[model samples]
Target: MHDSHSERMSGSETRAASGLALVFAFRMLGMFMVLPVLATYGQDLAGATPALIGLAIGAYGLTQAVLQIPFGIISDRIGRLPVIYIGLLIFAAGAALAANADSIWGVIAGRVLQGAGAISAAVMALLSDLTREQHRTKAMAMIGMSIGVSFAVAMVVGPLLTRAFGLSGLFWATAIMALLGIVIVAAMVPRASHPLQHRESGVARQALLPTLKHPDLLRLDFGILALHAILMASFVALPLALVEKAGLPKEEHWWVYLTALLVGFFGMVPFIIYGEKKRQMKKVLVGAVAVLFLCELFFWQFGNSLRALVFGTILFFTAFNLLEASLPSLISKVAPAGGKGTAMGVYSTSQFLGAALGGILGGWLYQHGGLSTVFVGCAVVCAIWLAIAVTMREPPYVTSLRLPLSAAAVADTGLVTRMLAMPGVADAVVVAEEAAIYIKVDSEKLDRTSLESLIESAPERAEA
Candidate 1:
């Protein structure tokens, strides 16, 4: 039997994946760097309030959520690089605006503008264009890892940057980062030779409704939404807890974050290894959610103690890192073949929307009720998510395949039927417009020789 397996990436693939991952890291660092210190810094700005501070912290998410899908769609129409170019410019402008802002509302406006860039989907689409189907998952994972690393770095560095240059200076640094991203996009990233319709890459309008209605996908989407919501909401009060309740000075906050993040990263490894090696993803996922719930509860019960806060922070980051890494993998497995792009677009939107809601909700709870209320709200959300997660089916082991087709084959219904009938082929979609076929198959069982022979024998049809 011919196994449908991926090979080690080529040098070009490594370069492309790494460069783009760095691009994502720079952008994410800019956003995350503000998260740890924004609450404290906002207090000094004119018209500052707890609610508005939360809004400012999360305002970018609102614009990002609203624009991510549209940006992906636009990339499909106009090409990926152009969309990325525009987005980087917008992000740079937002960073500059934030850097110059003197009031809380001004910062909020800047954050909103920052969110408006909404290039994540476009960036992923470009990655798909640049890489082979077999290597795409690795590319995606690189980007995911970059985001996680950026978060850790940002948590540790945000305080130091604020101490050195102040909040406005931090924004200036982000603007510089954005400019650097633009340069990387232009020079380092490879260009696609032709405009390819990547069913696994960019959003398809027709696929949106079906993708959204998928029960399993919906569960994952809601999981990410609740996860990020709790994250944003918790941060609204966490810094305050550190400063006021734990008596940690602002400058020393990095020590706590560095310690917690290191512990969390180490703690997440075993679960990841066990889940992947033993095929216990569902069990691991449920456990992570439950741990997240308990982390919040711990925050509520031990909000005033340094040791408890340290322990809770460690647990919180462990769960966060695990979920962050796992959710995209699950989505890729669970999403219908050929609709991966649309499914991911929706997933990204949900993630950002949750951040926005978390900020708004967390701020409100903190303003009216207190940190305890924020923790309680986060716990409630996690509990509901955990309930939903319990009913989810374990995702099957599978991978996507994109095969080029001639124009004549595009019209051949029999070709699709034959492909679908092949053993280990779980789903097959023939997109005539794209002149390609997309398939999902059990990699271990797939008969690649038969499939390749069939494709080799098919006559090429002339394009119109």
Candidate 2:
């Protein structure tokens, strides 16, 4: 049977994938690095109304969610570089605007502009352009790590940055960082054509509905949306809980962040390794959600002691890390091949919208009710996600095949059709020069005897 995900990546694939990964890391670092301290520091600024403060915190997500797909389509039409450049330029302006602001409204305006950059979808599309089908998962995983690292760093450094240069100084520093990113893309990064188009596809509306309709992809998207909403809402309630219940000082809040991040990093590794290697992804993902549900339950009951809150925080992040890693990997595996970019675009948008919604709703919830209510709200969210996750089907197993190519192989238009007709073969992608096929298949139903007989009789049709 034919299979997908078999080809070993070429040197160029590694380089381009790594470069795009770094670019996204730099961009996200600037955004996430300010989040941990935004609420505490914004209190004394002019025009610092509570509602406006929430907007400042969430404005970027609103913009990023709204613009991500449009910017992606723009990149498809105009070229990746131009859209990336424009996005960075807008991002820089937002940073500069924040740096010079004396009022909370000014910061809100700056954040809105920063969100306007909306280059995530474009950057992902560009990575797809650079890597072949077989290596795309590895390429996407690199970007995921970049995002994870950025979040981890920001959680730790957000407080330290504010302590040293204040929020305005952080803004200026981030602007400079973004400017450097622009230079890297403009000079150091090599231009790549879309692998499918390898020519101009000038910005056209990416068909969005197909991704929205895929049941498996839809489940993962819901996971992402709920996951981020919980994260944002957690912060809204957590700081006050630390102050009123746990008696922790504001400046010392970073200690909580640092410990949770470290613990979560170490704690999540084993499950992540086990799930991927053992092919127990569905179990691990559901178990993680169950843990999240328990953590929220714990949060509602225990904020009186620093130790308990610290433990609860650690547990929460551990589950968060697992879901964050697993959801997208599964999405990549299940997404339709030709429209993976569009699927990802919708996925990113939903994720950001959740973040924005979390911030806004969390504020209202906190203002109206106390800590218990906020936590109960998060528990409700995880319950919803867990119910959705219960419905997800087991993913198909992928197999790799290698063959030597000839001129005849290049010209065989019917080869793909023949491969698709094979029993147990769910999906197939082939590379001519590489002479390899990556396939998704039903492993339990694979007809190994028939496959061997065919290869024995027709050696040229041999499987790798």
Q: Which has the greatest lDDT? A: 1
lDDT of each: 0.88, 0.75
* Candidate 2 lDDT, 34-81, residue by residue in tens: 677776777768977545665677778899999987887777678788
- List TM-score per model, in order: 0.95, 0.85
Cα RMSD, each candidate: 3.0, 5.1
Model 2 residue 145 CA deviation in Å: 1.0
Q: TM-score winner among the candidates? A: 1
TM-score of decoy 1: 0.95
Candidate 1 least-lDDT 10 residues: 455-464
Residue-level lDDT for 243 in candidate 1: 84
Residue 130's C-alpha lDDT in candidate 1? 82
